[model samples]
Target: MDTQYTALARRFRPQTFSEVVGQERIAQTLRNAILENRVAHAYLFTGARGVGKTSMARIFAKALNCPNTKDGVPCNECEICRGISAGNDVDVSEIDGASNRGIDDIRSLRANVNVRSMRSKYKVYIIDEVHMLTKEAFNALLKTLEEPPPLVKFVFCTTEPNKVPDTILSRCQRFDFGTISTDNIEIRLSQLAEAEGFTVDQEALELVARRAAGSMRDSQSLFDQLLAFGAQHITAADVHRLLGTAPDQRLIDLIEAMIDRRRDAALSQFQVALNDGVQLEAFTDQLLNYFRDLMVAACGAEGVQLLSVGRDCLPKLQEQSRRWGLENVVAALQIFADTKGRMQRVTYGRALAELALVRLSLLADMERLDDLLSQLKAGNAVVASGTARPTSAPPPRLAASTSPVPAPSLPAQKKNERLTPPPAEVASGADSPVTGSRDPAPIEAAAPPPVIAFQPGLEAELHRLMLSRLTDMTGTHLAKVVSTAISGPNRLDFSFSASYDIGRKACERPEVQARLESLVKELTGQDVRIQFRTVVTEAPEAKPQPAQPTNSRRKVVESPEDPLVQEVAKTFGIERWLRQEVLAEVVEAPAGGDLPEE
Candidate 1:
């Protein structure tokens, strides 16, 4: 006969509150409840999966019903205790809420609620995943739950407590179980491995514990699967292979490439990971978690305890964190997070992964605007993260022309030169005689305009600087400017077509003018006024034509003396202008010199 093999998870189930791992608080509370005889009629336990909610429920049930209970702990030797541990106890029932979640099931359970216990002080009813019960079923259990028989006690367990109705929740004592720490889970695995006589590396156990993500059952189950490898000794390489996870070194190399902004190197490392059979989704997820750790490291000494990695990797992580500033780390996290979601929706996830890698690599050179602003506000030079610019460096100036446009060949103004303006009264018109023969009031002296050593491209450079400073409407308006020139020593003029009246007006805005003036000061180191003017070119006037002759409109009569009549007679081969009256005289005279008809 062959022996049946029991899985580690089932073989190692906790039978007593003291044996339950990673839930000491709940266990102690339950023990106090039992010791004080204050156990509630209905109790609710909630937590993430594999965090001992169900185990705590069963242990509590055993403690309540065990005949040989000691200090709220059940003696595993007794028949009733063994029966409860084996899940065959008559007085203590363990129900699967998922399987029997309808009103009929609740009805049947309710019908049995009043029956006396067969052999225990209290009949404990434990329902796992109580949130799975339907609305009607919950309603059916409410009355019984709120007012249960003195001998009946109910324990409700669920991972999703939010799904449980408030009415049901309000009637029970609720205890929330937290996830087991990685160290605790690792320790448990080590103990299991030693008991099973299988040698396992410490790192391997850590890998399994971390992979469990705070679930004790998951860790045990994973360890069991690893044991099936049939090897007497387990290693980290084997765990990595089984989980399809990239080695930490590989992940570090890949991150280093990204930190250095070496896209090709990062892509190559990613390909290597793929070649090593690492799933793209898993790889992206791991990268995101790595950045999360980097964020923790960036927080400095206070976060060292919060790191998931061991001390061996701490120094490296801190170095990487320094290289990738907090801002860049956050940006990388966002990029990878988005890529992770996209990879799930597409068949070709490798492309998204590669694109994310490229984006992360490019992030090395990028600086957050807010960071720069803060630095500037602090009186520090706004340098990029990886750059070596000095803290006290001045703002980069635009390169000036090597040979500035030569100053006009005029006598250089003396340092104390002053220009006097003529009196307004005399300046209006010298022809106007003074009404009172009083000498014109002494002219008020005015400061001479500062002369600038102009550059040929000064206007162009100022325009460029202004364009860089302005945005949106102002920038658009500045773009339509046809030309820029220095109309006066202290006045910069911008010319536009007359058709662009609106644009010129936009440029005349006070803010726009102020920005232009500031740019001028920045470029020439002198105060300059800005002026906007429109240019219109008029078309040439048409010349007047010579006056027409006065007699040109006269009408002409047909006569023999007319040249036109002679030309017509000669062309037709007949006498010129042969009159009808002449023919009548010639014919009538022959016939008695009288006309035949009037």
Candidate 2:
């Protein structure tokens, strides 16, 4: 007889509290509860899927019901422990809330709560996906859940605790199971591999662990899939091939090409990756992950612990991060992220990816505005490197000045003119002397900007300023004003249309009134009062309709003499009096009322 094969996830399931990986704190809490004889009536285990919520629940149940339990850990050799482990125990029941999630199911459960346990010391109920229960069902189970029998305990598991009611959450002790870290998951995978006699590469194992995304069961499942590759030795190449991702070296080469502004080389590398069966979405995902590491590396030694790449690749990654500066690295991440989004929404992923690559290549000379400003302040001319694209004209020089005279335009100035103001212009009392130069006149404080007098278009100017400063909603509210008039020397009245009731109410808010008052004071040289009024336009009177004669009524479409009615009645063997009575009923019914059917 052939033996049945079990999956790695199932074969290596955690049996004891100590065996449960990545959740030591939770396991310890449950064990302490059992040891101290202070187990609560209800427990709420919440977390992402496959993080051992169900496994923890079962372990807790076994610990509570096992006859030979020691130090809060169940001895799996006993009959009751074995039954619970196999999930067929009579005393402990595992219920899937998704299937049995109605009021009737809760009623049945409530009815059986008072009964004595079949064999174990306690009757434990483990409900998975408890958030799927209906509102009525949850309400029905509330009282029983809040105050169950002393011998009965309830353990509720959910992936989304937000969907669960706050009432239910308050009645139980909640334990949140966080995702296993990459290191912990990798260690667990190595243990499993050693037990299974598999010679897996450390890099391969790390790749699988990282690919799991902080789920132990997910990593174990992925490891099982790799075992089917029919080889005793598993390499990093196998992991990349299985995951449909480009190799680390290939991705590194592509990034280097982009950093060097070699557009053709980058495109060639991208094409090669695609041709090697690297999926577009996967390729884009790998690029995002690599660039994320680059961003961390740009943070210097403090972020070295956060890197996901192998030690062999860390030095190269740090070098690349330096070459592609932090600003450019961030820009590249945004580009790939947008490309990934487009790939998810459309089928033309290759085109979007190629466009993103070209855009990244152009960012080789990208610099932050602050850096450029610092360079200019230090009297250094900002020059583009050879890798930067050529322009028809050189960039204009920028210099700060407080003089009334404006800087000359490029056409009016010579090819190599200094950016400093001329000595003739500086000698005027209006201009300040240049930096580090001996001045003939003492430096004076710069004069304030001249304020213009109130003009006819003052309201228009205020409205423009409001539009620039306020949000779209507030600006729209202000725009709904029908007209603005000068009610007094220092007061402006804004009239709203009758239809702009909401807008008028919005403008009447205290904050909006204060903002308008400040704008008015700023525009005019004095405190100005702003008033908002609504124009109550009278609605036009509705016209009276001409009366119709009482004799004119809706005629009945069906009659006893109608051919179709007669046919239907005769076909059903209807009597003459029955047909007459039906017609009378139809005719006597109000025009708006529905007719009766036989």
lDDT of 1 at 572: 45
- Candidate 2 TM-score, C-alpha based: 0.65
For every model shown, what is its TM-score relative to the native structure? 0.65, 0.65
Each model's lDDT: 0.77, 0.78
- Which regions of candidate 2 deviate over 4 angstroms? 301-308, 365-598
Q: What are the candidates' C-alpha RMSDs?
A: 19.0, 17.1
Question: What tens digits encode model 2's per-residue C-alpha lDDT throughout 154-272?
Answer: 99999999999999999999999999888898899999989999999998988888888878899999999998873888998888888887778898899999888899999999888
lDDT comparing candidate 1 with the true structure: 0.77
10 residues in a row with least lDDT, candidate 2: 421-430
Model 1, 556-594: lDDT tens digits are 433455665455446545453345445323322332444
